[model samples]
Target: MKRQLHSCALAALTLLSTLPAGAQHAEPVPSEQRVTVQGMKNASAWFKAESQHFVVYSDTSRASVFQLLNNLERLDYLLRLYTSAYGKPQPLESKLTLTFHKRPGALAQFADTPPRDAVGLYSSCSAGVQGAGVLLAPITELANAELSKAPVND
Candidate 1:
Protein backbone atom coordinates (compact mmCIF):
# COMPACT_ATOMS: atom_id res chain seq x y z
CA MET A 1 0.00 0.00 0.00
CA LYS A 2 2.87 2.43 0.83
CA ARG A 3 4.62 1.70 -2.51
CA GLN A 4 1.37 2.32 -4.44
CA LEU A 5 0.85 5.70 -2.71
CA HIS A 6 4.41 6.82 -3.51
CA SER A 7 4.03 5.86 -7.21
CA CYS A 8 0.73 7.77 -7.49
CA ALA A 9 2.23 10.89 -5.88
CA LEU A 10 5.23 10.78 -8.24
CA ALA A 11 2.97 10.40 -11.26
CA ALA A 12 0.85 13.40 -10.20
CA LEU A 13 3.95 15.55 -9.70
CA THR A 14 5.31 14.63 -13.15
CA LEU A 15 1.97 15.38 -14.81
CA LEU A 16 1.70 18.79 -13.14
CA SER A 17 5.29 19.71 -14.13
CA THR A 18 4.56 18.93 -17.80
CA LEU A 19 1.75 21.51 -18.00
CA PRO A 20 2.40 24.81 -19.81
CA ALA A 21 3.78 27.73 -17.78
CA GLY A 22 2.53 31.28 -17.35
CA ALA A 23 -1.11 30.42 -18.04
CA GLN A 24 -2.16 33.05 -15.53
CA HIS A 25 0.02 35.71 -17.16
CA ALA A 26 -1.48 35.25 -20.63
CA GLU A 27 -3.46 38.18 -22.02
CA PRO A 28 -5.89 38.35 -24.89
CA VAL A 29 -4.16 39.77 -27.96
CA PRO A 30 -5.80 42.79 -29.45
CA SER A 31 -6.90 42.52 -33.05
CA GLU A 32 -4.57 44.26 -35.54
CA GLN A 33 -5.80 47.48 -37.06
CA ARG A 34 -4.34 50.17 -39.26
CA VAL A 35 -4.35 53.60 -37.68
CA THR A 36 -4.38 56.78 -39.73
CA VAL A 37 -5.01 60.49 -39.26
CA GLN A 38 -8.37 60.24 -40.96
CA GLY A 39 -9.22 57.14 -38.93
CA MET A 40 -8.59 59.06 -35.72
CA LYS A 41 -10.66 62.01 -36.87
CA ASN A 42 -13.51 59.69 -37.67
CA ALA A 43 -13.48 58.19 -34.21
CA SER A 44 -16.55 59.95 -32.85
CA ALA A 45 -15.78 59.11 -29.23
CA TRP A 46 -12.41 60.88 -29.30
CA PHE A 47 -12.07 64.49 -28.24
CA LYS A 48 -10.06 66.95 -30.26
CA ALA A 49 -8.02 69.94 -29.13
CA GLU A 50 -5.69 72.32 -30.93
CA SER A 51 -2.87 74.59 -29.84
CA GLN A 52 -0.63 76.89 -31.86
CA HIS A 53 1.69 73.99 -32.65
CA PHE A 54 -0.19 70.79 -31.86
CA VAL A 55 -3.45 69.10 -32.90
CA VAL A 56 -4.32 66.52 -30.26
CA TYR A 57 -6.89 63.72 -30.44
CA SER A 58 -7.45 61.81 -27.27
CA ASP A 59 -10.06 59.78 -25.44
CA THR A 60 -8.96 61.38 -22.19
CA SER A 61 -10.67 64.37 -20.66
CA ARG A 62 -10.67 67.64 -22.60
CA ALA A 63 -8.85 69.37 -19.78
CA SER A 64 -6.03 66.88 -19.93
CA VAL A 65 -5.69 67.24 -23.69
CA PHE A 66 -5.57 71.01 -23.46
CA GLN A 67 -3.00 70.88 -20.69
CA LEU A 68 -0.76 68.51 -22.63
CA LEU A 69 -1.00 70.66 -25.76
CA ASN A 70 0.02 73.76 -23.88
CA ASN A 71 3.08 72.03 -22.44
CA LEU A 72 4.02 70.67 -25.87
CA GLU A 73 3.91 74.14 -27.40
CA ARG A 74 6.15 75.47 -24.70
CA LEU A 75 8.62 72.62 -25.18
CA ASP A 76 8.62 73.18 -28.93
CA TYR A 77 9.43 76.82 -28.46
CA LEU A 78 12.30 76.00 -26.12
CA LEU A 79 13.72 73.43 -28.50
CA ARG A 80 13.57 75.83 -31.41
CA LEU A 81 15.29 78.48 -29.37
CA TYR A 82 18.14 76.12 -28.43
CA THR A 83 18.55 74.81 -31.97
CA SER A 84 18.42 78.30 -33.48
CA ALA A 85 22.00 78.90 -32.36
CA TYR A 86 23.21 75.95 -34.44
CA GLY A 87 21.37 76.74 -37.71
CA LYS A 88 18.64 78.79 -39.32
CA PRO A 89 15.21 78.12 -37.78
CA GLN A 90 13.05 75.98 -40.03
CA PRO A 91 9.36 76.63 -39.60
CA LEU A 92 6.72 73.90 -39.57
CA GLU A 93 4.30 74.12 -42.44
CA SER A 94 1.52 72.61 -40.38
CA LYS A 95 0.71 71.69 -36.80
CA LEU A 96 1.74 68.21 -35.64
CA THR A 97 -0.95 65.66 -34.70
CA LEU A 98 -0.74 63.70 -31.45
CA THR A 99 -3.11 60.78 -30.81
CA PHE A 100 -3.41 59.80 -27.19
CA HIS A 101 -4.89 56.40 -26.36
CA LYS A 102 -6.39 55.40 -23.05
CA ARG A 103 -4.18 52.32 -22.77
CA PRO A 104 -0.93 50.85 -24.09
CA GLY A 105 -2.78 48.14 -26.03
CA ALA A 106 -4.77 50.75 -27.89
CA LEU A 107 -1.63 52.68 -28.75
CA ALA A 108 0.05 49.56 -30.04
CA GLN A 109 -2.67 49.11 -32.65
CA PHE A 110 -1.75 52.46 -34.16
CA ALA A 111 2.01 52.04 -34.10
CA ASP A 112 3.74 51.49 -37.43
CA THR A 113 5.52 48.14 -37.25
CA PRO A 114 5.77 48.35 -33.50
CA PRO A 115 7.67 45.88 -31.37
CA ARG A 116 5.91 43.19 -29.36
CA ASP A 117 5.93 45.40 -26.27
CA ALA A 118 5.81 49.04 -27.36
CA VAL A 119 4.86 51.74 -24.90
CA GLY A 120 4.87 54.71 -27.31
CA LEU A 121 5.41 55.63 -30.95
CA TYR A 122 6.68 58.77 -32.66
CA SER A 123 7.04 59.41 -36.38
CA SER A 124 8.74 62.42 -37.95
CA CYS A 125 8.04 63.49 -41.51
CA SER A 126 10.79 65.36 -43.31
CA ALA A 127 8.59 66.21 -46.29
CA GLY A 128 5.31 64.45 -45.85
CA VAL A 129 1.72 65.59 -46.30
CA GLN A 130 0.01 67.79 -43.80
CA GLY A 131 -1.08 65.84 -40.63
CA ALA A 132 1.23 63.01 -41.60
CA GLY A 133 3.58 63.87 -38.77
CA VAL A 134 1.78 61.79 -36.16
CA LEU A 135 2.54 60.53 -32.67
CA LEU A 136 0.77 57.79 -30.72
CA ALA A 137 0.97 57.57 -26.94
CA PRO A 138 -0.90 56.45 -23.84
CA ILE A 139 -2.15 59.09 -21.41
CA THR A 140 -0.65 58.90 -17.92
CA GLU A 141 -3.71 59.62 -15.86
CA LEU A 142 -3.19 61.63 -12.71
CA ALA A 143 -4.74 60.51 -9.46
CA ASN A 144 -6.04 64.02 -8.82
CA ALA A 145 -7.79 66.04 -11.53
CA GLU A 146 -6.26 69.27 -10.20
CA LEU A 147 -2.78 68.10 -11.21
CA SER A 148 -3.80 68.00 -14.87
CA LYS A 149 -4.16 71.76 -15.08
CA ALA A 150 -1.47 73.65 -17.02
CA PRO A 151 0.18 76.73 -15.54
CA VAL A 152 -1.05 80.07 -16.76
CA ASN A 153 1.23 81.41 -19.49
CA ASP A 154 1.73 85.11 -18.91
Candidate 2:
Protein backbone atom coordinates (compact mmCIF):
# COMPACT_ATOMS: atom_id res chain seq x y z
CA MET A 1 0.00 0.00 0.00
CA LYS A 2 2.80 2.45 0.81
CA ARG A 3 4.61 1.67 -2.48
CA GLN A 4 1.41 2.20 -4.51
CA LEU A 5 0.81 5.64 -2.95
CA HIS A 6 4.33 6.81 -3.77
CA SER A 7 4.00 5.66 -7.37
CA CYS A 8 0.70 7.50 -7.77
CA ALA A 9 2.21 10.75 -6.50
CA LEU A 10 5.16 10.48 -8.91
CA ALA A 11 2.86 9.79 -11.83
CA ALA A 12 0.76 12.85 -11.04
CA LEU A 13 3.83 15.08 -10.90
CA THR A 14 5.10 13.69 -14.18
CA LEU A 15 1.77 14.24 -15.89
CA LEU A 16 1.55 17.85 -14.66
CA SER A 17 5.01 18.68 -15.96
CA THR A 18 4.37 17.08 -19.33
CA LEU A 19 1.04 18.85 -19.75
CA PRO A 20 2.67 22.29 -19.60
CA ALA A 21 5.31 21.25 -22.12
CA GLY A 22 2.70 20.33 -24.74
CA ALA A 23 0.10 23.02 -23.92
CA GLN A 24 1.68 26.34 -24.68
CA HIS A 25 0.40 29.67 -23.34
CA ALA A 26 -1.42 31.82 -25.84
CA GLU A 27 0.82 34.36 -27.62
CA PRO A 28 0.29 37.89 -26.42
CA VAL A 29 -1.17 40.46 -28.81
CA PRO A 30 1.07 43.44 -29.36
CA SER A 31 -0.14 46.66 -27.77
CA GLU A 32 1.37 48.85 -30.44
CA GLN A 33 1.56 48.07 -34.14
CA ARG A 34 2.89 50.03 -37.13
CA VAL A 35 0.41 52.04 -39.20
CA THR A 36 1.27 53.07 -42.76
CA VAL A 37 -0.05 56.32 -44.23
CA GLN A 38 -0.25 56.56 -47.97
CA GLY A 39 -0.21 59.74 -50.15
CA MET A 40 2.21 61.50 -47.86
CA LYS A 41 4.43 63.24 -50.41
CA ASN A 42 7.80 64.76 -49.54
CA ALA A 43 6.89 63.75 -46.04
CA SER A 44 9.15 61.75 -43.77
CA ALA A 45 8.34 61.89 -40.07
CA TRP A 46 10.09 60.91 -36.86
CA PHE A 47 9.91 61.84 -33.20
CA LYS A 48 12.75 63.82 -31.67
CA ALA A 49 13.63 63.43 -28.02
CA GLU A 50 13.33 66.54 -25.88
CA SER A 51 11.93 66.22 -22.40
CA GLN A 52 8.17 66.71 -22.66
CA HIS A 53 8.66 68.20 -26.08
CA PHE A 54 7.50 66.12 -29.04
CA VAL A 55 9.01 67.49 -32.24
CA VAL A 56 8.00 66.02 -35.59
CA TYR A 57 9.98 66.68 -38.74
CA SER A 58 9.27 66.44 -42.45
CA ASP A 59 11.06 67.66 -45.61
CA THR A 60 9.46 71.13 -45.38
CA SER A 61 6.78 70.83 -47.98
CA ARG A 62 3.89 73.24 -47.54
CA ALA A 63 1.36 70.52 -46.90
CA SER A 64 3.68 68.37 -44.85
CA VAL A 65 4.64 71.32 -42.69
CA PHE A 66 1.05 72.18 -41.95
CA GLN A 67 0.10 68.59 -41.26
CA LEU A 68 2.97 68.04 -38.82
CA LEU A 69 2.24 71.24 -36.96
CA ASN A 70 -1.42 70.40 -36.69
CA ASN A 71 -0.64 66.92 -35.43
CA LEU A 72 1.68 68.29 -32.78
CA GLU A 73 -1.01 70.59 -31.49
CA ARG A 74 -3.48 67.75 -31.26
CA LEU A 75 -0.96 65.56 -29.49
CA ASP A 76 -0.26 68.33 -27.01
CA TYR A 77 -3.92 68.61 -26.16
CA LEU A 78 -4.28 64.88 -25.73
CA LEU A 79 -1.26 64.68 -23.44
CA ARG A 80 -2.52 67.51 -21.30
CA LEU A 81 -5.99 66.09 -20.96
CA TYR A 82 -4.76 62.62 -20.11
CA THR A 83 -2.19 63.84 -17.61
CA SER A 84 -4.75 66.02 -15.88
CA ALA A 85 -7.21 63.17 -15.61
CA TYR A 86 -4.51 61.23 -13.78
CA GLY A 87 -4.17 64.12 -11.27
CA LYS A 88 -0.72 64.93 -12.58
CA PRO A 89 -0.43 68.17 -14.48
CA GLN A 90 2.68 68.12 -16.62
CA PRO A 91 2.89 70.54 -19.51
CA LEU A 92 4.75 70.08 -22.77
CA GLU A 93 8.11 71.84 -22.73
CA SER A 94 9.15 71.91 -26.36
CA LYS A 95 7.65 73.69 -29.33
CA LEU A 96 7.36 72.20 -32.79
CA THR A 97 9.64 73.78 -35.41
CA LEU A 98 9.04 73.52 -39.13
CA THR A 99 12.17 74.00 -41.21
CA PHE A 100 11.86 74.05 -44.97
CA HIS A 101 14.39 72.20 -47.07
CA LYS A 102 14.55 72.72 -50.81
CA ARG A 103 15.88 69.27 -51.63
CA PRO A 104 15.63 65.53 -50.86
CA GLY A 105 18.57 65.04 -48.46
CA ALA A 106 17.53 67.94 -46.24
CA LEU A 107 15.57 65.91 -43.73
CA ALA A 108 18.45 63.44 -43.29
CA GLN A 109 20.94 66.26 -42.89
CA PHE A 110 18.75 67.79 -40.20
CA ALA A 111 18.52 64.43 -38.45
CA ASP A 112 22.30 64.52 -37.90
CA THR A 113 22.01 67.69 -35.86
CA PRO A 114 22.93 67.05 -32.22
CA PRO A 115 19.90 66.31 -30.06
CA ARG A 116 19.24 68.73 -27.24
CA ASP A 117 18.78 68.01 -23.49
CA ALA A 118 15.04 68.42 -23.98
CA VAL A 119 15.07 64.76 -24.96
CA GLY A 120 15.69 63.79 -21.36
CA LEU A 121 12.85 65.96 -20.14
CA TYR A 122 10.46 64.43 -22.61
CA SER A 123 11.50 60.92 -21.63
CA SER A 124 11.10 61.64 -17.93
CA CYS A 125 7.66 63.15 -18.41
CA SER A 126 6.64 60.21 -20.56
CA ALA A 127 7.81 57.84 -17.84
CA GLY A 128 5.84 59.72 -15.23
CA VAL A 129 2.73 59.64 -17.38
CA GLN A 130 3.15 55.94 -17.96
CA GLY A 131 3.82 55.34 -14.28
CA ALA A 132 0.52 57.01 -13.52
CA GLY A 133 -1.06 54.60 -16.02
CA VAL A 134 -3.13 57.31 -17.72
CA LEU A 135 -1.47 57.75 -21.12
CA LEU A 136 -0.97 54.28 -22.49
CA ALA A 137 -4.02 53.66 -24.64
CA PRO A 138 -4.30 57.12 -26.19
CA ILE A 139 -0.57 57.32 -26.78
CA THR A 140 -0.58 53.88 -28.32
CA GLU A 141 -3.41 54.88 -30.61
CA LEU A 142 -1.57 58.05 -31.63
CA ALA A 143 1.61 56.13 -32.29
CA ASN A 144 -0.22 53.60 -34.42
CA ALA A 145 -1.79 56.37 -36.48
CA GLU A 146 1.55 58.07 -36.98
CA LEU A 147 3.28 54.84 -38.00
CA SER A 148 0.57 53.95 -40.47
CA LYS A 149 1.22 57.28 -42.14
CA ALA A 150 4.88 56.34 -42.52
CA PRO A 151 6.09 54.97 -45.83
CA VAL A 152 6.33 51.21 -46.08
CA ASN A 153 9.37 49.69 -47.76
CA ASP A 154 9.30 46.53 -49.83
Please give, for residues 1-154, the per-residue lDDT of candidate 1 as tens digits: 9999999999999998896765576688985333346646552556667888778767666666766776677678878888888988557557777776655566545555666665456676665422211223433433334444843321
What TM-score goes with each of the models? 0.49, 0.27
* Regions more than 4 Å wrong, model 2: 1-59, 86-94, 98-154
Task: List clash counts for every candidate, in order.
Answer: 0, 14
Q: Provide the global lDDT of candidate 1 against the true structure.
A: 0.62
Candidate 2 backbone clash number: 14
Best model number under lDDT: 1
The TM-score measured for candidate 1 stands at: 0.49
